[model samples]
Target: MYYIGIDLGTSAVKLLLVDEEGSITSTVSKSYAVEYPRPGWSQQNPADWWEAVTAGARELMAGVDTAQVRAIGTGGQMHGLVALDAAGEVIRPCILWNDGRTEEEVCFLNETIGRERLSGLAGNIAFAGFTAPKLLWMRKHEPDNFARIAHIMLPKDYLTFRLTGEFATDYSDASGTLLLDVEHRCWSAEMLEICGVSEAQMPRLMDGAEAVGTLSAAAAQELGLPAGTVVAAGAGDNAAAAVGCGAVAAGSCNISLGTSGTIFIPSDGFRVDAHNALHSFDYVEGRYHLMGCILSAASCSGWFVGDVLKAEDFDAEEAASDPAVATVDLPYFLPYLMGERSPHNDTAARGAFVGMRADTSRAQMVRAVREGVAFAIRDCVEVARGEDIRIERSTLCGGGSKSALMRQTLANVLNIELDLPETEQGPGYGAAMLAMVAAGDAPSVEACVGRIVRMRGSVVPDPQAVAAYEERYQIWRQMYPALKPIYRQMAR
Candidate 1:
């Protein structure tokens, strides 16, 4: 009994092979290309994803016994649009989660369609990167292709379909599509009508750990795995990462800082914000979670160090930031490098350093990068607080979490203890755990997490620093709304 998890990411498909005991036996990754036809647009060929997965699977199990493989699960980037025609032909390259080409469609949904109505129907409002807006964008801009669509899919769902020969998706993935009634755990016909689509175009939905179907013959042969390997209904990348970090229980939180950053607060009952800011999505545990995401996080640091400063060694660059080490706050920073999402759904927004002076040092600039991400995340935490959710502590995992300075910054900024997981394998680990549960190797997702995942250590917030960030966070929330109209105009 073994399981393989495929993490279909923005740039690559990461394949992980794990035994029944949660030990990782093999790990492989294959990168793919993303095309940008326009400045704000991002797309990837479904063929590219399939090729990477097939190649990665072969590499991951080359020396292992493929016969022992029991199940396959996925954790993938959310809200990317993948379309196929009646004959199952790839209609076009998928629009990615970071694609901002659907601003017009997003405006029409949030303004004309009304956020309240959209939230009522789907438990969340539309964002430019959501699959539904991408659908509308296709309908408006690529009418010929839209006319031929027989099946609509998300990024990872494309992989699942190729593996299982089943046109199905999980609730967590569907929730980000702006087409699902997340509370009801089903497609919203009203939302479909609103988007000028129908239920026929959607896939059958399931919880993340449920078995969708067995692997197809072609897929099994390509990957050198058993033909009957169970393909579980996998989750969207964030949800998968949450489960990977064992953030499935009520009141548990996991912060992800990839190209985008998110604060995922897991809960048992369903809840939506009055402003429709945070998303209420179905969790892998058959429960619900509230999430808030910002489009740019660590990428801001990369940009500052690589592009702005023309420096490559980020660690060396960060180590120079003495101002952030003890008791001083950077005077200015706004890390909206690629617009923004969550509390501020402004695609027109741009990044800036507002209060810089002649005295601003390279270290201070670096510290600003660290502090800006923290302040932005705290914005989402405030929204969660307004909902009466209390987060005394949180689990941290991500590239950003690797920075001791950043971890300390986040811990204090949020005024909470940040715990690191024992098996912090990110999304792939969680997906493999889900596959184990579906394969009957584990009793449940919760049980498997309790058994396999452990807390390594904790980063505690300093009361003094928390007080400093509280003052800065209060100021950070003001800058966005004041900058909103400017962002809108710039988008035009």
Candidate 2:
């Protein structure tokens, strides 16, 4: 039997074909453009996603036995608002997770509605990227479109609807919407009223590993797949990635350094931090997890190298940096290129190169970018530590984890061992694991994860380097607070 995992990302839809034994046999990726209609307003047509998925699935199953494919699961970018009218046509371009146009709505929710009340109702504070604020934005700015909304779903959920003709979403993905009472694993009526939405607008909730529906005949024909293939309720990208890294059990931690960075800590019971810095949400495994996200992680390094330096060879540039410079007093690069999320929910926050000297070299700047991201991750780890969550080590995955220097930098910066997973496909792979559970190929998520997820090696922190990074991190921590007022003023 075979299972397919579709990761509907911001830039692309990645499909992974995995067998019952947990080995990936084939993969396909289809890219799409993200529309920026205005500054800080990111959107994408839902039709574009369907187009990519159909094209990618055909390519992924070209030589494979279509009859053998049993189940399909998806993992996608979270908090995107995909609204549909009563006839099921998309109301407008989806407001993407990275969009910052909900600033006014976020302020209204966090300040006017009250942070304490919001947190109590939804298990999280309002951030500009969450779904509720975006809904409120539409209600205020695009009331005509908002009024026509009959169904609301996340990005991946929309794809599932297209495939199975089911309007449903998994708990893990819905947790980021600020409309779910995450602890109860259901929609919050209070939050729904506040967003001026009804419960009927929300998708039916399911566990990530549960089968939402079978593939429709139309969808099967479009993708050249077998009809009646099981479609599992998929997870948000981070939760799905956690399952990929075998972070389903309590006390398990996973750090992803993709376009964004996240420190995910799984717990058997739900717990919210007093500061509300970390997000308490339902995990893909039906428990709970705390996630701390940095808006820009590897993307910051990408911008520095590709845009600023006009360099394409990232490995070579990263290799050029001297390891001995770990002890040197270097400039700090705030990795808030797209503002910050966790701990500091400041959308006005901007990236900066502080303490740069005339003598600083390109390699030093590169090192700074890496160190800055690592430090920002450390800030998140500190919040988890404050909650008494002991993270001695964590499973590391994502594009940034491929860099040995970055692995070492993160290990030292966090002063913890970082384990590299054998299959670092992240969300796509995790979605496949969920498919396994839904298809009865695996008894449970934990059992499936244990059998599939393998650790390759560990990156241990150097004592001296950890001490050096500690001092540098303390200095870097102060830079954000010092520049906070400046960023707000500049925004004005």
Candidate 3:
């Protein structure tokens, strides 16, 4: 049998076809535009997402036997607030996960409502990207639209609803909304009241691998797939990526360097960090995981190379760099281009280049961008360490992981072994694995992951590079705290 995995990303929807054996057969991607109507605000139309997925599915299944397809699952960008009216039409363009227009709402939740109360109810503190803050923003700013919110869902759950005619969400995705009582695995009544939302607005919750419903006849005809194909309750992008890397077992770790970066550590039991630096969310495999997310990762380098330097070839740039100079006299870069999450949940924080000299070379700047991302990831590692979760080694995946320089830098910076997966499809592959379980081709999410996910190789930390990064990271840590006052002033 064949299964389809859809990764509904920030900029595109990637669909992958996998056979019963877990080998990927074909893949297709459909791109959509993200709108920045105002500075620090991001939005996307739900109609565009449905249109892309349908078109991409047709392309993915081209010349293939659609009758052989048994199930479909998705891993999507999480925390975006997609609201629907009574008639099931999208009330407005989704407030995207990276949108930072919720500063007032976040402050209201954290300072006014109190972080301890919010954390006790939702297992997390308010961040600008979370759905609760977005909801509050809408209520205060767009009251008419807020009043029409009959149903609320995340980005991927909207796709699942379109396919199965079911309003359902996986625990992994729901946990990020700052609405779920994550420790209890349910929606918090207190949080619902605080957000001025009712429980009825929420979607039915399920484990990521559990089948929510089958494809509707209309959806099946539209996509050229068999009717009644099971649709699983898919996960948030990070949790899905973790499953793809076989990071479901307790103490297992996975680091992703996509547009955003994360340090994910799966746990057998629920555990919240004292500082609430790491997100405590339900895992796709019916366990729990702590995740620390940085707002930008590979995008930092992308910005430096593409936007700043106007260069397209990253590998060539790295190849041409002076290896001797690359290792010494490097400037520090604070990669808070979209503000920061995890460790420091400061939305006012902005990116900056500190300790730059007049003679700073492009290669040195490039190295700084890469190393800066590594250091930001190390910040999360440090937080997890504070919680006594020792993440000595982790599986790494995503667009940034493709760079050898990044892989080596990350390994040395964190002083941890980095394992590269044979198939770095990340969320797409993980969604496919969830589909396998939903279709009964696999027993459980963990077993399916164990059978399929393979590590290609590991990057062991070099002693010399590790020592050098240790010193640099200490200096890098001080940069953020020193700039906190400036960031607040700049925001005002």
Q: Runs in model 1 with CA error above 4 Å?
A: 324-329
lDDT sort, best first: 2, 3, 1
Residue 113 in model 1: lDDT: 95
Which scores better on lDDT, 2 or 3? 2
Each model's RMSD to truth, in Å? 1.5, 0.9, 1.1
The lDDT values for all models are 0.87, 0.92, 0.91
Each model's total of backbone clashes: 0, 0, 0
TM-score of each: 0.97, 0.99, 0.98
Q: Candidate 3: where is the Cα deviation over 4 Å?
A: 322-328
lDDT of 2 at 306: 95
What's the residue-level lDDT of 106 in candidate 3? 93
